[model samples]
Structure formats: C-alpha cells, structure tokens
Target: MVVTDENPSAAPVTVPVAPKRRLPGWARSVLWAVGVVAVLSTASYLTGVNTLTSTNTAQIALRLALPILLAGLGGLWSERSGVINIGLEGMMILGTWGAAWGAYHGGVWAGLGAAIVFGALGGLLHAVATVTFNVNHIVSGVAINLLGLGVAKYLSTLIFQPLSGNPRQSPPVPTFDTYSATFLSDWLSGLEQQQRVGISDAAGLLNGLVTGVAPLTMIAILLVPLSYLVLWKTRFGLRLRSCGENPVAAESLGISVYRYKYVAVLISGGLAGMGGAALVLLAGGGGYLENQTNNRGYIGLAAMIFGNWRPGGLLGGAALFGYADGLRLSGGGKAVLALMYGLVLLLVVIVVVQLIRRQWLAAALGVLGAGVLYWIYWANDDLPSDLTPYTAHFVTLIVLAAASQRLRPPRADGARYQSGQR
Candidate 1:
C-alpha cells in the first residue's frame, strides 16, 4: 500500500561530512619556522656572508651537537612516557664524575659503564619521586640539578685537591694522538700551508678538524638513526608512548605503564649520563670541573623541543645550536657576534610562531625584522672582546629554543592515565 508513496518520493539521505579543520596554531608556527630557517640557510650559503668556515664550522657544530642531541633524544623518551625529568643536568654531571673516576681507576670502557650506572640510579630516583610519589616534576628536576652539582663539586675537591693547588695544570686523561699517520700529517700540512696570510693559527684549525672526527663523533652518528628506529619502530617505543599519552588505554591493552615509564626515564638518565661522560672523557680530557656540562643539559632539552620530538629533527636542531656555540667560542668581535646569534634565534622563534599559526605573512615580517636588526648590529665595529663568548652563548640558547619548539610528540605525551579514562 505504501509503494505509491515510496516510488513517488524517495527522500534524499544526506551524509554528514565534517568540514576539514585548519592545522593547529602550533603546527603552523612550526612550518613557518622551518621555512624561515630554510630561507636563511639558503641566503647564507649563496651569499657566503656567514663568517663561519664551512668545513671547520660543520665539524665543530657536530662535535657540540652530537652529545646534546643524544641527551635530548633521551629526554624525548622520558617525557614521551609522561614523566618530566628535570634531572638531566644532574644525571649528566653524575655521569661525568663517574666516568672520570672510573677512568682514573679503571679503563675507559669501565668509566663509561660507571657513568651509565650512575645515570640510571639518578633516573631511578626521579622515577620514584615523580612516578611513585607524584612529586612536582619541575621541583624534582631542580633538586636533582642541585644535588648533582653539589656532589660533583665535593667529589672534585676531594679527588683533585692536590691538582687544584697547581691551578693551571689539571690532571690529564689519556689523550689519543690523532696525527699518527703519514696521511693525516700530510693533510694537516696541506691545510696549514693553504692559508699562509692572516692565518695566525693554522695548527689550531688542523687540530680542531682532526679531533672533531673522533671515536665519540662516530658513535653519536650511529646512535642518531638507531634512536629513531627504536622510538618509532619498536614495541618498547610503542609502550613508552602509550604510557605518556593514555596510560589507562595502554594498561588495559596489557601494557604496564609504570614499568614502561620507569624504563623510559632510566634510559633517558643513562643517555644523558653518557653525554656527560663523552664531554669529560672525549672533549674535556677526563677531568671534573664546575659547570663542566656548560648548560648542555638545558640546551639538550631545547634541542628536544626544536626537533619536535623527532630524532631526525633533533639532529638538525642540535647542529644549528652547535654551530652558533662554535662561533661564539671561536674568538671574534663579541658584540657583533652576539647580535648575530640573537637575531638568528629571534628570527627562528618568530618564524616558528608564524608557521604554527599558518600566518606566512607574520613569519615573513619577522624574518625582515631579524635581518634589519642583524645589519644594524653588524655595522657596529666597537664590540668588546670579552663579551664575544657571552653573546655567542646567548645566540646558541635562542637558536636551540627556536629549533626545539617545532618538535611535537604524540598527542598523549606527558599525561598520566587512570582507569576508565581515555
């Protein structure tokens, strides 16, 4: 009986199709930042206006960036597991001390192992406080940093008290002579001879390059891709991310969130410790000193952010920061150098913010502003010599921050999961 009506009028079924939403502000900002960096890098390379020697600069950048990158990746693991580890600096310091102590008493490998153990202990402490007791992550981190510094200082005084008396001459770690081969010697000789005029220190250049490509550098290179693989392609990584994003979901799915979190935090601590060990053993020649890490832990944190929580991205960010640092350490007009460094950072941040917001116009304006500022500062010829390093340091910090802000972990990062909660 209803066949007449059904045939006469077939009501149209409208399927509700959700409108495509624009990218989040943060995501746009990251894109803008990347664009700006690309533009600037291209300009620098094409113009050859960048004062840095490409070969030496790259080598130096890698040297500094590698250690920090490793530490930052470790931080990524911990934070991704919903555990905020502020104790990275302290862990690194402990590792440095442990490695130095181990090397002094045992062998280099023993020292490295000691650093890892010490670092793991530091991580365990953080895990107990944050995961078990649910302490404020920031406070816990600060405490760890203070504890590390205090312990390191006391230990340094106790062990190197005699050496301290002689101030200039500190105890030496076993330094491997890099220029043992004839080919290496020939290369150095050629480099020295290449720049005959205005080259006051060719030896320094040669030594820096030779030392840059050390065993530690090689190890760090290997670790980068390995880290990427582990974080993205492994079961451990999945568990770690799940714990950070939605612990309840992961737990229901038969994942022990606590165990995963603990493991992640400890592994982070161990990696940071290894970074410290590398700094002292490979870079600083196995000596304990105050502020030996030189804010690298903090930098590593920024690097993690810059990399947008991606291992590959982190390497690039670290390299940029490292290059900025190298320039500062290279001894030039401090004020101008500082200005350049600041400009780089400011530009990077503005670009990042714009990208995140999908405001290309704003990013472009920021780049212009940075360029103007840089030119103004570059024109000033009377910068203080002593202030150069400080300027460079500030620049490096800014760049690192800019680069790190682009990093984005999975949606569930740094959150705790409870039963029945998504």
Candidate 2:
C-alpha cells in the first residue's frame, strides 16, 4: 500500500503494509468447484433439468465414483513416491479375485482384507521389477497387468467353477449394512420438493448425501481429506515426495529413497485393491464376475491426470465422470442433452471468471464455446443413440482439454532412479 505525503510541495511517500494472504491452492479449487455447482444447480432449477440434481443421479454417481477415486488415490501414492503405477489395473484385477476368494470362504470384511493383500502383492511385484531389477516402469506395469489377469482367471476356474457353476464368475458375496440419516434426509426431501431455487438445490444435494449411504461410501469419501493431510501436511509425506522429485537428493539426505518408494507402491496397491473390493461389494451385487472392473482402473488414471496429480482435483474429476455415467444410465439422452445446457451455463460462469482475471483471450474462447454449445442444445431434442454410451469418456476428454494447460507431474514421476545417482 502507498500513501501520499500531507505536505503540498513534498513528493508523495510510499508506505508499506502487509499484503493480504491468498487462499491455499486446495481451498481455491474447492471454491471453484462450489461456484460451478451453484451455476449447474441454478441451471437445473430454471431449465426443469431435475435429473442434474436428482437423488437417484447423486446416489449412482457416488457408486460409480468410488472405484475411480480409490484408483486415482492409488496412483497419487505411487507417483508421489517416485514411481508411476501404471499397473493399477492389474492390482485391481488381483483385488477382484482376492475379494471373491475371501468372501466365498470368509465374509465381506475378509474379502476386503484379502483384496488389500492381493493388491499389495501386485505392488510388491512392481517394486521388484522397477526398483530392484531396474526394469522400465511401463514395461513392469504391463507385465503385471497380464500376470494379474492370468492369475485371476486360473484361480476363478479352480475355485469358483463348482460353486458358482461358472468358470468366469463367483457366487454371491454378502454386502455390508447400510444406514441413512433419516430425519435430515426427510427434511431435505421435503424442502427439495418445494422447488425453491437455492434452497431446493442445497436440499437435494444434502438429501443425497444423508440418504441410504453404505459404510464403504463414507470411508471412500473420507480418504480424500485423509490423503491430503498425510501427503501434504506430514513429514513422512515430504520425504516420500522428495524421492519422486529428486531421489538422489533424498538419498543424500539419508531419506532412504528405495524404502519410501517401496512403501508408497505397496500403499498404492492396497488402495487399488480397495477399489476392486468396492466394485464387488458396493456395485457388483453379484459376488464377482469376469471383467467386472470394466476398465475403471484406466478411467481412474485419467481422473488422476485430470486432477493434475492432486487429491482434491482427482476427487472433482471422479465426481464429474461419475455424474455423467449415472446421467446416461438413468435419464438417457434427454438428461445428457440437459447436461449440455448446464455446461453452457458453466462456460458462461467461466467467461465471467476469466474476465475478472483479465484473461481476455480465454474469456473470448469461453464465450465462443458457450455460444456453440447452446446452439447445439437448442437444435437438438436428444443426443444420438450412438453417442449415449460414451458420455463419461466424452466429459473426461473435455475436462482434460480444459485443464491440461495447468497440469504438472512430479519431476521424476516415471523416471528411473538409482541410489546416490543424479
């Protein structure tokens, strides 16, 4: 800050004051998300696009988002520790088999436990190949993927064929108990039905959160904050991340680069295993089946990339894709077309934000995009049937394109590391 001198003939004197502190990166991201949500909710309320905030849509979104959330978190753990875990899919596959085997022989909790162990094993294998033997990270990951698939298949045929009467699937696994905050949900439901703009919008969202959520859902949601605390706030996290950024420097500091990398990879596997168990217990309904993962591991990796390798960013990415998936399943093309309208609103909001930041070119592009999208929305009653199935992928591409400019990975995220070597 500056102030002028009182003397008429005196030159103005500059005064210094402390600059205002800016919000942290995570906080800013959250605020941006909240702003976008507000725009979307208002669009829903005005356009009669109820599906955008419907309880059913929200519920399904939670279910779909869980695996991706976990998988992306897994990638974070590995990458932060200086290892790129492209084997997340393989780990998930191992987890599926472990879950089925444990659930069949023990119970649901046992299944979850077994999955973690199995996933950890896959992680261990990755560590052996990449760290101990100096194998290429991508090559090690690909080998693990094939190995996991083959192992799952062999185990399934040997263990599940007689019991399930099918080689490709397992018998039903008992699901966990579910609970709801009935009172809050009821109140919110009532308010939502009243159709009062922001009030209804808040009620709808709160209602979805409080109504009929599984214990695993709560656990999955909690992991995001827990991860941020551990990875960003703790000393251990700093050391682990150091290995990713500069393993040689970390080793020089006696940080034990190999140890941190190993730990991170194992944790990565365990998280991915949890993702698999989530799929079987929460969404599968049936115990386990062949190819049940449905490439969610790959999608999770995409979510991780979209988030620029941050926990909060990945969470937002996962939720966006999940919402699109659920929308396609529940409302078909009309709901998707409704989403296009909401996107236009969101783009307009983006334009306003860009203008505030004096980003003229970006604001201009946003305006052009919004105009084109709204024109498309106005001309179409529904999306073509052929395009309906790729809704999640479509959204993922757009988001990645929008966010790609800002993404930065760890310095040595996928680089080969050697002890005491730069």
Q: Write the per-residue lDDT of candidate 1 for residues 1-422, one digit (tens) a residue.
A: 12233555775556667889999755865775565444434433433334343345445666677668767877888888888777898999888888777766776777778888888888888888887777778888889889888877777777756755532222665422232335764566565446432231233234445544656566667887887788778988877787887788788898887788889999999988888877766753556566778778887877777777777667766766776666555535642444364456657777887889999986887787677767756677545766665643565555554445354566765454444555
Q: Each model's TM-score?
A: 0.74, 0.92
Count of residue pairs whose backbone atoms collide, per candidate: 17, 0
Residue 74's lDDT within candidate 2 is 95
The 0-to-1 C-alpha lDDT of every candidate, in the order given, reads: 0.68, 0.87
Best model per TM-score: 2
Candidate 2 wrong stretches, greater than 4 Å:
1-20, 25-30
Per-residue lDDT of candidate 2, residues 4-106 (tens digit) = 7788888777888889999998689878767766876877876788887778777788888888999999999999887888899989999888987887789
The CA-based lDDT of model 1 is what?
A: 0.68
